[model samples]
Target: MTTTISPSRKTNEAVRPAKQPLRDRLVRLQRRIPIVQLALLVLVCAYGLATLPGFGSWMSIKSILILGALVGMAALGQSIVVLIGGIDLGVAGYIVAGALMVTQFATLNNVPFGVAFLLATAGAAVLGGTVGYLCHRFRIHSIIVTFAMGSVALGLAQLQVAGAYGGGAPVWLTQMTSPVMGTLGLPIPPLVLVWAVVIVLAALFLHRTAAGRRLLATGANPRAAELVHIRTRRVWVLAFAFSAVASVVAGVFLAGFAGNVDVTMGNPYLFESLAAVIIGGTVFGGPGDYSRTVVGVLLLTVLTTVLVGQGLTGADKQILYGLIILAAMAVYGRERRLRDQV
Candidate 1:
């Protein structure tokens, strides 16, 4: 007689392994990565509020919101371009250009607030579109092209100023953004409202529109996207245009806040926007969420505020920012590899 396996052994052999749900698998994978950055950011914000005198005060909060809002808008735009497998190093340049447009209009032409804002925004968009065209038509890398464009934009702004403040902005533009909306002892800055609108609109555009999906697909695989009849070049152009719009909006807001335009107003934001995008989990030329970008911007704003309060110089802040971005990239790289393997 042949040897027979035990009933328990047969049962064990017959039992198939349970498969994890997709959602569960995603959650587990997310946990494997260093996702604690978000929590850490929250903790840091709380610490800043508790330790820094007046840090939690209304004025401090308003200041953070206003600054964060402007930076967040630009970061959102940058994140979109990055998601589409491109980079726009021209954020600061576009911002400066936008601000200068408004200042020049108001100072020289005596343009109305509405007209100046529209002209500035439209001008920035055109600049962005031109950069996109240069990249697509010449088969140049977006990064190199945008970097050069940024230099040009910066130069133009400086040329306008010619070693002095660009005169001054219109009175109405200053008044519109300065007066805070007070509700029950809380001040809501106009920049905060602008930021909220941009975030919501961007989130919707990325998640709810077919064009957005096409952009993502183009970024994920341009060759495949083109094969599928998606106008990859147009998507690229649109991405740059969107980024320019963000920069211009931010510049306009800044103009209102500062009450005038200076060539250097946008210099600091170039790196800040990049940091915010990276820290928000938007990998370079990879999938990312705008909501996360917003959170990242807020986190950065808080960190910078605390650092300044602690007497850190601008150079020190820049160094720390660079380190943080590097750390985020490292983490993202590992996670990306893991995802590819899976």
Candidate 2:
């Protein structure tokens, strides 16, 4: 006897078996951890310990958290933009402008801190959105536009200060930088709480939302994303806007940490932020990776504090950063080429 299987039944069988659970895929992704980033973090921490006593002190620990929170926030912001095949040099502008504006409003104009915060974030969003729009609408390179915009922002920050700049932090702002509580006999800085919230929200936004997946898709292949009806332009705009928001928030934290703001104050963040993103295992053309960026931020902050404790000058920091940037790019570029070849 010959048995006949219907085509529909065969198709159904294939379809049912081909379906894989989302949880399993997520488990696999988690297993494929970025080991190198974590390893580098360990190495950096050890070096910091070897270099300075401040690496272990409560005061140094507090400073690292504040600085890490600020730089990590900025790096993560840049990571968002970077993932979408666009670079945001304007993040520097946002840091300078946002800090200056927030402080200017709170100090010079007597605007409430809450109101100033909103205004500063709004301004950053506008600036970032403008870059996003220009990139999508005019097909301009974000690198060029963002770079120019950043310069413009720096100039505006300088003008806003008008020689009235002094590094005096508000009482409330200072309080925010202090420890909220202690754990295991170690004080935990309040900024850690804020950073944790930002990171958690960021992770959820990028991993658990449709918009987040679309962002990844768009960055992976804009043409393919468009073909799939992904609304790539909207993705670009939103990514940039989000990045701007991160930059501004970072600026606020940094301004609080520094107890003041200046146009040149944000200068170091530009290079360091990009470097942190790179070292965090988020390569060029990669999507936002919140956890790794946080690690990178800590590494950099620790390194910075260590150097400061050793009385290292600005030139020494620059040299160290320059070397790290060069080495990171060399490694990433080579690996990318190898991956492409593979």
Candidate 3:
């Protein structure tokens, strides 16, 4: 006579062991994702220094910081949208608006830069708020609303300039973004310093403010947030408004960086911003932070610089970006929505 296990016992044993493996796998994956990204950044940097001429040169390094700052600034806004379970496709349009604003209002018309900047940011807030309101009120996905809003913004911007969007930034502004110009003689671009300051402020706003907590709560679970009287719709409105304003700021500085402004000046940043946010391990509906975005920005900049040094064509770069995004998705896509965790 042999002892026999009950069906219930067998089921428990089998199911428990199965779950442990899955749980272990998930834990390992969570640990590996960030480490892998950082490791890749290091590896890419090493490869660049070894194989790419001028990759580690002072000018090249400065170029990387400036380029990364632009992308990081744009991605900063995208991070807010993603945190709130939304995406802002209108970033490019708002960037154009800002660039055009500086060109038309400040440079061409000779309005003061400070006044022009305020007007541009205020207008962006209104447009972005409207986009958020429509999405919330109508229960529409942000992708559709923002895409339409972006097109409208672009058209309006073009119409405003009457197809004559051409101007140079003020000389002082240009110097501010120049690679040779240092912050307080510290050998760092002023634009880079500004980016660093913005990053610090953003991190503080997200982690230290009540409003920031509310935004995170809304993204984690809108219905739950509403049940708790969090006013998620308002959060949405403010989030998108901030997104627009951030894009505008980036655009203005970017105009200075390039010394000129155009309606299409912000086109490339559209996808790059979203790509950086995604690559930064920030999932939709919360569960991410600005620090991750910083790492992602650095990685992307270094990788892109290396690729460019290798003489990759535009088409090839696009293809590579697509593949990199897909890889990031594979790693982070499986995360449970923050709502579930909540």
Best by TM-score: 3
Query: Candidate 3, residues 1-342: lDDT per residue as tens digits?
Result: 999999999888887844457767866675445666788899999999999878899988998999999999999989999999899999999888887777765655678888888888888888889988989999999999888887776677666667566677778888888899988869999999998998899889888999888988898899999999999889999989999999988888888888777767798899888888888788788678777888889988898888888999878878988999999888677767768877
Candidate 1 structure quality by residue, lDDT tens digits, 1-342: 899999999898789678889977865665444255578687988889887999988878888887888788678778888887678888888787777767765566566667767876776677788888889888988889888877776676556546455556666556545545543454676557767887888889888999888887777777777898999889878889878888877787677778777767887887888888888777765667687788788889999999988899999999999998989888677654222432
Off by over 4 Å in 3: 1-33
Q: lDDT tens string, model 2, 55-75?
A: 777776676787788788888
Off by over 4 Å in 1: 1-35, 154-164, 183-186, 337-342
Ranked by lDDT, top first:
3, 1, 2
Model 1: lowest-lDDT 10 consecutive positions: 333-342
Worst 10 residues of 2 by lDDT: 333-342
Return the top candidate by lDDT.
3
Task: Kindly report which residue pairs in candidate 1 clash with one another.
Answer: none
The total of clashing pairs for model 3 equals 0
